[model samples]
Target chain A: MLAGLARQGVELPSACQAGACHTCLLRAESGDPGEDGRRGLKPTLAASGYFLACQARPVTDLRAAVAGPDVITPARVERRWWLGPRVLAVRVRPRQPVEFRPGQHVTLHRGNGIIRVYSIANRPGQARRDGLEFHVRVYPGGQMSEWLAGAAPGTGVGLGVPAGHCFYLPGQPAAPLLLAGTGTGIAPLLAIAADARAAGHRGPVTLLHGAAEPARLYLGEHTPPGLAGAGIRWRACVQSRGEDIAEAAADELAAQPDPAAARAYLCGGRGSVTRTKRALFLGGMSLASINADEFAPAAAS
Target chain B: MVMTSDPRPLYDRLGGKPAVDAATEIFYRKVLADPVLSPYFDGVDMERQVAKQAAFLTMALGGPNHYTGKDLRAAHAHLPGIGDEHVDMVIGHLAQTLRELGVAEPDIKAAGAVATSVRDEVLGR
Candidate 1:
């Protein structure tokens, strides 16, 4: 449905086009979205004609518009700082309570109509309330990144519905958590690890992050206090000049004991995510137990 | 004339997308659980694999031919270690999945025949 609409020159807000991300959610004013289309949506959202446009295959003519109030939350930049060369950490607080899991991503809408998907790096219900932190890798000549690099605090922005499958899921307190990511992909993994700890997970949690050079490894020796728990292992992997960070991270993860039984969350660039996912799978992890969030590069406008 | 077969396309007989979805889901679960077949999917995105498999199965069952004639052959040509045995194992899993899902004997056989028809292509012959 989304592709067909695009062919007709109607581009909808979309990311992770596989229905895992709710960035393309739309309100169907007329047609019925079958159960499959609303599979993971909240009952209330489904009741109000909301469906994932990427998943909807309407048999009859359908009219849908970008969702308003129900999906868009007004937010403001609370703080911004440089974590490393080309890495910016920004915090935004939603004007209204926007419930979201730590590792889920939100579509950040700047006033100028530029939007980019970013994973919330902080856990929900912190002492500061609804502040969402994002670790952004500012790319040279990237519109959103360039704007964000100099955006002042308190600047208004709109957030799309927070959606992603890579967040920490409860009810598996005893399953070991293995998180691996490259570059800013560590944002969501860190959030997921903190969430697991907050949920009182008793299993061991191991976090592995990799970067091209030591200077690019921002989170270096500072493991978040939230992740301080028994049997926790946090390691920053820095490879030699031209080595692939993704493979290096995957090698470390595959070396972990009992990879098959571990609940793994992998995020980062496409190559990194794919390599790490393959490593874990080959290391005996069940594909169902592995969740990956591959960052899609925004088309330069 | 006595009709020994239902004239409907196997896709319809298999009950469309929902049925194909169910079959493919069950089929992958079974394949992944089987040590012999699971390695073939190493590093392959399971979700995409399921979707592609569903589309291929749908076309094979005569629903829609979204696939080009050389797609299956071309895809398998690059993968190592695919032999006639692997093809048979996959067909067996497909038939077993339909059977477990309560598909009638004739329908399962028809589906198996469709899968078997692509045996050489799937084997990269």
Candidate 2:
């Protein structure tokens, strides 16, 4: 596809032609792009005909153009609360309802071209006018985090289209779900667990949240009543107290007596996400069954 | 042997993208289960790899060659520690996966030949 386009005098910006770098993203204005071309793009982008030029072998004639600037939805801060010393829970109300799943992320656009991606921490349409929820990790002097920490209700912000493939997927109600995260990464896992239960997931759902210490674990004291009722078990793993969260979570998963297939969702810092994924995969989880969302360092932010 | 000059691309004969997708699901499972190969893929997201593999396999089996020869060499050169043994093992897995999917012996051999044709570039030799 890339070659054909170049031959016809069309040049697409690209790097890592293997599709690792999404630099060659193009929008199909007319025809269907292969799923492989849209593989890791946000569901919303895929649905709207965005695809990777490097990966797509177009079966149908596609009228494609370079992806334009992201569409930004205006939003307002509705509420803010501290999840822990370092984690701030934020709720924002978009001007209109933003279609997003439980665990996908959106880029919060501050003025001056500054934007940061955050996972949506609540399921859409669950609470009236709740809008979107985000668990922002407050880094001292961090531009976006500091602003969000002090932002008042009605403070305006811009939201990029909901993006990312890490989200609660319906179907397979009986499949066991194992979720693990560290720090504010638990935000998405909470919503995913709730989404699963609400969808009538019957198999055991276990969530393990890891933090440096007990005091840093915000949800340790309170498991949402709705989640508790949904039979989702939540465990807090603290590293300061000698608990290796990844290993502990992997052990619990390996102990499951049933041979039923299980899916594991992991989030958090890149290192921890990679570590947990390796542990889970090594402990008999298939590579395809493990999903992860690694919080990239604020290089772009 | 009868299909040697069948005029149809091996990709079409082995079935199209859907067939490649099915073969990849089985192939990667075998690769990841192999102790020697699994280590190379540790901590990698298999879902994305599966998609990329499907595309690559489709090209290898005589589908649209989206990757330029240079792109192909660069892709393989970036993988650390990939050697002749690893390459052979990967091809073995692909062959086995096709066999499991009931692909004909001749078609499987043709696929193997196609894969081997690019072995030097794949190994960055």
Candidate 3:
């Protein structure tokens, strides 16, 4: 069965060839299936034939596909950069043509043979250069971080195409947009705001960027030049000065009329993202209208 | 008020680091083929990315908190261009990962809820 799928060029999700990550999950359309040690599968899914393809070898001829229609494809790295001590930017191109709404992320295959995920920081069409762009921060001693720090330009890498669900939805033209981001987390938010402006969006757009210190913010030069005159309000909040940028932004958002009508996007440290969401939700924005992404260090290995 | 039985200790239920490590690897392989989600990893270093994710899972699942690194927003601020579809794509990946790990339906739902809770911070919608 595996040979047939490979012959058909049907690639399944996998990571840690040692039976980890569980990216390739499928349900048996019809067949007797066996299971192995990969975690995350529920008895219900198992009873219904759900199994991780990486861990399960077909006992008999098996017919299967991902339980959901969402299939992940590998992306090729087109660019790389060292933004700061720990931040890196990698641009990836999809093996196939694709489109995304903005504020999404893709999983990356590092030189050390590990797969990590990062957010898309370039506008949808703007990535026309060769591949999509991603912003990553390296954690000291992190498998990918150490490799990226020493990697020279044109280094080959692996990636998964746009994978996150956080993005902007159209049809709320009159509603105010409050976009807040910290460090690399700002990548997706910036893409959303930029796309809105480039597409001639007319709603009031405000961007509040925060970092530990002013120097930590990386994309000052790459900020969309179009937003300066496109009615998109931009602000930088440096939290090291003891000013709660997220709180201030939330307060400003609260002052707006019909807070429920406003849409808020918050990205950054887990603490700030959590605080911003709580503050804004309590300030009256509808929970459905709020979108966020939180990036933090991996738990100890 | 009496607290409900908290299932916060899901790491043990999911088979700890070995299980999580395996699931993380499979999840990345799937992400690579996903047209909608693969673009974000264009120039990424896959090895380090994998380790960071594993470390993150370790901490997220209430295991040992070894992920002493920068927060998410700071790490991703450079790209500055993401959207709704991207956010949704990530959530979908997380959901798929959970499904692959053999996590129970209730556990998967709980994990989804955690992912949903952070959607705003991720997409900046």
Cα deviation at A60, candidate 3, in Å, is 15
**Candidate 1: tens digits of C-alpha lDDT, residues A120-168:** 8887876147488899999888777888888898888888878778887
Candidate 2 residues A1-301, lDDT tens each?
8768889986655534555335466899898878779887767778878888889998987898765555567889999999778789899888867887788777786665556778888888753367798999998888889999999999999876676667767777788899998988888898888888888888888999889888988877456665777788777889988987788778878877652378888988877887787677656666667888877755432
Encode model 1's per-residue lDDT on B1-125: one tens digit a residue.
11227687767766778777766667776776678987777767766887878876786566775776588888788778889888888888887877777767776677788788888877876
Give lDDT: candidate 1, residue B20. Answer: 71
lDDT of 1 at A30: 84
What DockQ does each listed candidate score? 0.13, 0.18, 0.02
TM-score of each: 0.73, 0.67, 0.54
Per-residue CA lDDT of model 3 for B1-125, tens digit only, reads: 11124555666667778877776666665665577666666545455676766765665555675443345555554655776666666657766777766566666666566555555555543
Off by over 4 Å in 3: A1-75, A111-113, A220-226, A299-301, B1-125
For candidate 3, write residues A1-301 as lDDT tens digits.
3334566986554433333233345677887557662244545546666666766767787777654423445455566777665678767676665566688765556533365656778876777765777777777787766776676656666543344546777776777889888888778887888876666667778888777886776655334574566667767777777767668777779767657689888877767876676567546564557787666444232
Candidate 3: clashing residue pairs, number: 120
The best-first sequence of candidates by TM-score reads: 1, 2, 3
- DockQ of structure 1: 0.13
